[model samples]
Target: MVTSGRTRAVKLDSIAAGAVDLAREAAEETAGVLGVGEYLGAYAEAERVVSHHFACPHPGYRGWHWSVTLVRASRARVATVDEVVLLPGDDALTAQEWVPWADRVEPGDVGPGMLMPSPDNDPRLEPGYTGGESAADPEPAEASVIRAVVSELGLGRERVLTVEGRDEAAERWLAGPGGPDNQLSKAAPATCITCGFFVRLRGGLGREFGVCANAYSPSDAQVVSIDHGCGAHSSVPEPERAKELPPPVWDTIAWDETGGLFD
Candidate 1:
């Protein structure tokens, strides 16, 4: 994992991967401070009460309940706080009951709704039978889902960094004397809804990324990626506000391979 003080410039994708690892730790730290133990105990009680009230039905019909954990995608860490609730019904959720958690959860937390089977459920090599699901079609990749989530929330995919770099800032702010509060430090947490977790990723003038503050609430889930950029995106920042830079030096490097998701 990349720490605060490395001199080398990390690629966005590489930094994203590293962010997942670091954010998880930060989330766990946050949870510990937020009193996860008390929350979990209450959550267990709620589960029992809810279960007793409505007997679980068969398979998909059952009233399934879940314990919620906050996850920070940047650091790929789960939050320490627990958000236990009875799975929501088809009707819209009450704001009083859920609005407070807007700071930590996101729609992507639910993951892909359900597994969709392909042509057949067979697992073989040839003729009529074929392998069940291809390796390429796994449940969901966090990277792709995150992109969708950002779109849905109207957050930016890019955060601008200082021309210098994060390490120099970290040394002055975090490592030197006064940590984080230093003017150069730009760290913010991104909370997912479906998962109910909050993780902090690095941000600032050097690294250009998006901010999707509108996505903090559960109601924001109704806003799909395709529908973003509409009037509803009032809280999203305009792209013109970001610090501009020349194209990455790497863009001109001879490409041995295409790192893009699609050919």
Candidate 2:
């Protein structure tokens, strides 16, 4: 406990002072009996209650303060202890409340007897059509134009890809490696838009992004921006193969053993 030289004095009423003294005595007695050490010099008084703080003497228990609160009745000269409690100091080692393992589980924390439930309103999922039992059944007559567009584009029956979805995909691709400022795109001769293997996507997205079908290209089978390109452009000609050399002729002449050559 520390007090500054310029500390303001708290003018406590006589009743409050008596309560504080009673709280200190009670705290001392409790600490002596429990062998928990003695109370500090500093004490707190509020209304009719006074708190006397004690130091925790137990090993491995640091930054813990024990306190005894004493309260006085109306017009009463004497005060009685309300309760004794252990509280955390400015720097205390405290443990969080005990939680069952089940309550502490995260997304990937899987184990036996653990049940994870899907949320009712997940953004990735849409409610199934309740008109027919079979999923293969054709859509009802009241289906909207958006549903027709989805079916025509082979997008899927459950959810229709909207303009917003296309914009989001374009934004992601523009910010990724396929963007105009990327190293591969900057050094290329021509953009994917001019490449013969560039397959334009369906709908509005085709204007900005397309699939590269050039097997030799780095972006093959992958979505690329209109202005993005690699070294393997479709217009680049293949190098010619070198011609093979003719086989060498062999001599059939025989040599005589007398140091003279015989043909």
Candidate 3:
């Protein structure tokens, strides 16, 4: 009813304007006396039409308003009731607007057997032959040869990760549990790259990332940044081991037997 901001207020129709009693009657008929409380105000929607608002006194609908729209024909002196409805006020508690299931899903929300299909034009992926491999046209001899080799090895996928996708993955791994920032990495004696248990990955990410092969490490079998580390690093000192030694023998009696020079 109360207009503010950049909303241009429309003039109240003469006949439909002051029909407070008529609006109240409509609201009472739709929602009863308990539903229609004190009158709020009138809203001029457009020419020859207006809406009356009333405090909603219904039990379940808190902070709602009863709206009764009235309209008058041209040159008509009387207003006719148009419709009655309940609308939420600014502070009303209402359910959130519905969203599609696809839009509502988050990471890890898709369990086993649930499919989340990616669009064909998704920016994260592109044809393997034309993606990270090379952008050269197949018409060129070298490019055609490369494509053939790629297909023969079953490496020519329908789609491969785009540069943006690779970047996103790198960022996620760098900020994950196997990154250099965690408490375990901070306390590690040596980094993954310096350990013999670290297996370097292939391709562009290989230079700064790899999989941790150390079973004792927290990052076992997981992708880790080069600088990420753990206490189980291969370079850590080994535990002390038992040493072999000759048995000792008594010498006092033997010395007396061998030192008798006078005898």
Candidates in order, TM-scores: namely 0.12, 0.50, 0.73
User: What tens digits encode model 2's per-residue C-alpha lDDT throughout 144-222?
Assistant: 4545555565655444445565677789888887778799999998999889999988777888988989888878888
Q: 1-263 in candidate 1: lDDT tens per residue?
A: 86887555422233222333333343344334332221211112221121111112224433332334322244533323333334434443334644534354553454567443323322321132122233225365755665555556545323323334444544433333123332222222211211222122334411321222446433232212111122223333556766788788677776686678875
Q: Could you tell which candidate, 2 or 3, scores higher by lDDT?
A: 3
**TM-score of candidate 2 against the unseen true structure:** 0.50
lDDT of 3 by residue, 204-261 (tens): 8888899988888778999999999999999889999998865558554444436576
- Candidate 2: lDDT of 185? 94
CA error at residue 65 for candidate 3, angstroms: 0.8
Best by TM-score: 3
TM-score of 3: 0.73
Q: Which runs of model 1 end up more than 4 angstroms from their true locations?
A: 1-147, 151-159, 179-263
Q: List the residue pairs that clash in candidate 2.
A: none
Name the lDDT value of residue 7 in candidate 2: 60
| Model 1 lDDT, residue 37, Cα | 22
Better of 1 and 2 by lDDT: 2
Off by over 4 Å in 3: 1-11, 32-34, 97-103, 130-154, 241-263
Error of 1 at 251 (Å): 90
Which sections of candidate 2 miss by over 4 Å? Answer: 1-150, 153-156, 214-216, 245-263
